[model samples]
Target: MAASNSIAENIAGSPNHKMLHGTLQAAGLVERLGGDGEYTVFAPTDAAFVQIPPVTREGWMLPAQKQVLHAILNHHVVPGRIDSAELERLVDAGDGAAILKTLDGRDLWIRRSGASYILTSGSGNKAVITEADLAQKNGVVHIVDAVLIPAT
Candidate 1:
C-alpha cells in the first residue's frame, strides 16, 4: 500500500498474504526476495492456490521439499522491476510476446490479452495479471489470477 514498503511487506498486507507469506517462508526465500532489489513478482491470490492440488501444496510446504518450493516461488519473480508499462513495451518489442527470464532460470512468456497482460509459463499454463503496478520499495507487484508452475 505504501511506497516505502518492500515487496514482502506488501504481500503481507495483500489478500493472498497468508499463502504467499507461508510459501516464501517455507522456501526460505523471504529474506532474499524481501531484500532490496528491482524485481517483479507475479503474486498469486488465495483463490489461485485452490488451483493447486491439496496434496501438492502440502508436499511443497514440507521441509524436505524446500528446493521445490523455492524453485516454484522463484518462477514467479523476474530479476528486474517490470511494471505494466515496461511489460507492454517488451511485449510490443517482441511482436506481441516477450520472453521474461525469471529468477529461477525459467522463461515466462508475456503477451497482451485485450487490454490486460497474460503470463504464459514454461508449462503452457496461463495466468492473467489482474492487478498491475503495485509499487514497493524493492520492486513491483502484479496480482495474478493463477499460480505459475514451471515445466518439469
Candidate 2:
C-alpha cells in the first residue's frame, strides 16, 4: 500500500476537509491530536452537518459552547487507526459485533450487515460508512453520512 498522508495534507487537498479542519482547529483539538499519533476519525461531511438541527449546529460553533463542541468532536474519534478491515475482523471474532471505546469515554458498537459496516453509539444512533479507508498521518478518516451525537 502507498504511504498515508497527514490530516493537514488531506484537509488541504479536499474541499470537504476545509470546513472540517477549521471546525476542529477552532475547537482547539487540532494541535493536541495532530502530534499525539494515529487516530481514526469518523468525519462527517458538510452534508452530514445538514442533518443536524440548525440551532444545534449554531450552538456548537458559539464561543460559549466550546465544551459542547469539544465533546461532539471527540465523540467522532477513536484513538487508533481502526481501518474497516480490522473492524470487520474484530466484529467477526466477537459474536459478529464488538464495542469500541471512544476518546470521550463512550462505547461505539461495530457490526456487519452482509458486506457493509455499521457503527452505533449508546443512544442507538447509527452512522453508515459512506466512504472508508482514507489514510492520514495521525490516523485514518472514514467519511460518514450522519453526525454522531453524544447522549445528553
Tell me the tens digit of each residue's lDDT in model 2 across 1-152.
11366665575466765556767876888775567577888888888787878887877888998888888778888888999888888998998999888888888887888877778867778888888888777788888877787776
Q: Give RMSD to native, each candidate.
A: 1.0, 2.2
| Model 1 segments more than 4 A misplaced | none
Which whole-number lDDT from 0 to 100 does residue 54 have in model 2? Answer: 83
- Locate the minimum summed-lDDT window of 10 residues in model 2: 1-10
Q: TM-scores across all candidates? A: 0.96, 0.89
Q: What clash pairs does model 2 have?
A: 38-138, 39-138, 39-139
Q: How many backbone clashes does candidate 2 have?
A: 3
Clashes of each: 0, 3
Model 2 residue 84 lDDT? 87
Candidate 2's TM-score reads 0.89
Quote the lDDT for 151 in model 2.
Answer: 74
| Stretches of model 2 off by over 4 angstroms after superposition | 1-4
